[model samples]
Target: MVVKTLNGAKAVAEAVKNCQPDVVACYPITPSTHIAEEMNHYYANGDTKTFIAVESEFSAISALIGGAATGARTFTATSSQGLLLMHEALFNAAGMRLPIVMVVANRAVSAPLSIWNDEQDSMSQRDTGWIQLYCKNNQEAVDSVIQAFEIAETTLLPVMVCIDGHYLTHAVGQVNIPPQSEVQDVLPPFKPKIFLDPENPLSLGVYTNPSHYQEFREDLHNDLLQSKEKIIEIGKKFGKRFLRTYGLFEEYKLKDAEFVLVGLGSVMDNVKATVNELRNENQKVGALHLRCFRPFPSEELKKILSGKTIGVIERDLSLGAQPPLYTEIVEALQGTNTIVSSFFGGLGGRNLDRTAIKVLFQKIKSKKPLKEWIAQQKGDQK
Candidate 1:
C-alpha cells in the first residue's frame, strides 16, 4: 500500500498488516484510537488473525501478554494515560521476556486532563526494561514497528515503537508500505523459542530468592546491553530487504557544522528543511536525530558531536530541570568541546515548525539559552 495521506496511526496499522502480526490488542485513546481502529479493520477483513478489543489499555496488554505467552506473535498500542494504566503490565511483559511489540503514540501526561503529544508518556516507562525506539517520521514509524518486532523476538524483550504524537500521529504524509511478497520474504513468522505449553509449562515471573533473582536480572540487563549491536544489525538486514537504509543515527550537514540540532521523532523533517535553507545561506548548522534511545548509540553520538557544538530540541520536559532528552544528550556528548545546548519546544501539540527551528538556529549561533518550564509529573506513575 503506497499511501499518500495516512497519518502515523494508519501508517502503523499498515505496517502491522505488512509485518503480519498474529495478535493485536489495544484500547481507545486520543491520537492512538486510529491505530487500533485500522488494525481492527484489517481483522474484520480477515487479513489479521486476531483483533482483541478489551475494556481498557491494561486489559488490552494483558490479552497480548497471554497471547504472546501462548506462542503467538502479539502486538499492542497505547498513549498518554493508557500507557500509565498498563505500566505494571509493561513490567510483567518485560520481566517475563515475552518479546511483545508495542506502538506508543507518545503523548503528554494529564493533570488538567488533555490529549496532547509529548514524549513523557513513553519516557515515563524508561526504566521498565522495554527497548525504546523513537521514529523521525511516518516512514520510520512504519519501518520501526516491523523492525521492533524482529529485535524484540531475537532478544526476548519487549520493545516500544515510540512516535511523536500529533506530529506523526495526526499529520498526513507519504509512507512507503512494502510489497506483500517482500514483507513476507523479509519477515518470517515469529516462532516462540520458549512459551507456555501443555506438554511442558514452566513458571513465569516466579519468585527467585536472592540466589537466582539477581542472576536473571543481570542476564536481562546483559541481553539488553547486547541488543544495541543486534538491533543495528537487524535494522540493516530489514533495510536491505526493504531497500531502506537506517544508520541508527541520521546526520545532516554535520560534517563541518559548528552548531547542530539533535532531535527525535517526526519534527526531524521540519528540522531537516530548515537546516537545508539556512545552510544554503552559509550557516554551519545541521541536525542529528536519534532513532533508537534506550540502547542509545553512545559511540555514534560521541563520534558525531566530537568537537562540534550541538543543540537538542527537547519536546519532553523534565521537572525541576532541563528537558529529559536534553540531559541525555549532554551526557552523551560530554568529555568533548561539543557545546551541546537545550531548547525545549512542542507541548500539547504545539506548532514546532520550520520558523521555530530557524529561531532555534539563531539562539544556537548566539549563546544557548533556557526559557522553558518543566511541568511536574503528578500521577502515581512517578
Candidate 2:
C-alpha cells in the first residue's frame, strides 16, 4: 500500500481498521477524542466492528476490559486525566492478562489545568506494569498501535502506545497504512486462552490473599518480566514488513563518538540534527533515542555506552529529585563499565532546539545529572 500523510488520530483509527478489531470502547478527550470520533464514524458506516462510546474514560476502559474478558479483541484511547480516571481498572486489566491496547496521548496533568505536551503524565504511571512504547512521530504513533496488539496478546499484557500531546497527536505526517490483506495475513484473529463463558463457565477475578497474591502477581510479573525479548522480537517483525526502525534503542553515529547524548520522543530529532552539525566541526558526538520505556534494556544500553561518556536529556521532570531516565541509566551503569551523566531540559514544551541541544551535547559529559538536568535543576537541588 502507498504511504501517505495522516493525522495521528486518523492514523490510530486506520490501524484499528486494519486490525479488524472486534470492539472499540472509548470516550472523548483532547488529542484522543479524534481517535474515537474516527472509529465511531467508520463503525457507523460499517467499515469495521462495533464501536461503543462509554460515559467516561473509566467506563470506556471498563467496557474494553469486559469485551476482552469475553474473548473479543478490544482497544481504547485517552489523554492524561482520562487515563487517570481509568487508573483503578488499569491494573485489573493487566492482572487479568487481557491484552488490551491503549493509545496514550501525552499531556500535562492539571493543577493549573493546562493542556500541553509533557512526559510527566505517562512517566508517573510507568510503575503500573504496562508495556509502554513511546513514539516520536505520527507514523511511529500509528505503527506502534498495530505492533502493540501483537506484543500485548503474545504476553497477555496491556500495551500503551504513547504519543506526545501536540507534537504527535496534532501533527500531520506520512504513514503507510497497512492494507487490509496484509493485516489479515499478519494479525491472526483473537482466540483467548481463557474467557467468560455461560455453559463452560469458570471462576475469574477470584479473591486471593497474600499467599496467592504473590503468585498471581508472579504470573503478571513473568509476563512483563519476560517482555524485553518479546518486545524486541515484535518490533523486528513490524520493521521487516513495514521498513520502520523499531528496537530497544536507536542510535545516531555513536560508534566513533567520545560523547553521546540521549533523549526520547520528538526531542530526539532535534538532538540528532544538532549532533550532525557538531560532527561537521570534528566534535565526535551522537544520540541514543529510547523507543521503549518499560522493561528498560540494561544490556543493550551498556553495550552502546560501555566505555563512552554519554549524556541524557529528559523532557520531563521526576519530581522531588532526578530526571526519570537519568536515574535508570545510572542504575544500568552502576557496576558496569560505562559513564553517562544526565541533563534535564525542556519541560512542558520549553523547546530545546538545535542551539540548546548543541550546548547540552557540548557540556553534557562534564556535569553531573543533578547539576545539568535542566538549567532549573541546580537551583532546585540547592
Once fitted onto the true fold, the runs of candidate 1 whose alpha carbons sit more than 4 angstroms away are 1-4, 29-31, 367-382
- All candidates: CA RMSD (Å): 4.3, 3.3
Residue pairs in candidate 2 whose N, alpha carbon or C atoms collide under 3 angstroms: 343-373, 344-373, 344-374
List, residue by residue over 275-374, the lDDT tens digit for candidate 1.
Answer: 9999899988888888878866677788878787677886776677767777877787778777766777577666677877787788777655445432
- Candidate 2 residues lying further than 4 Å off, grouped into runs, are 367-370, 373-382
C-alpha lDDT of all candidate models, in order:
0.81, 0.79
What TM-score, over all chains together, does every model reach?
0.93, 0.93
Tens-place lDDT per residue, model 2, 1-382, is: 6587877878878887888888898887553558888888889999988898878988998998888889888888888788888898888888888889998888777765757777887787787778888887777777788888888888888998888877777778888788778766556677878899996898767899887889988777766868888888878887777777587788889899888887788888888888889989998888888888887787678777777777888777777888789888877778765667777756665666787777777675563443465564222332
Of candidate 2, the 10-residue stretch with the lowest lDDT total is 373-382
Displacement of residue 352 (Cα, Å) in model 1 is 1.0
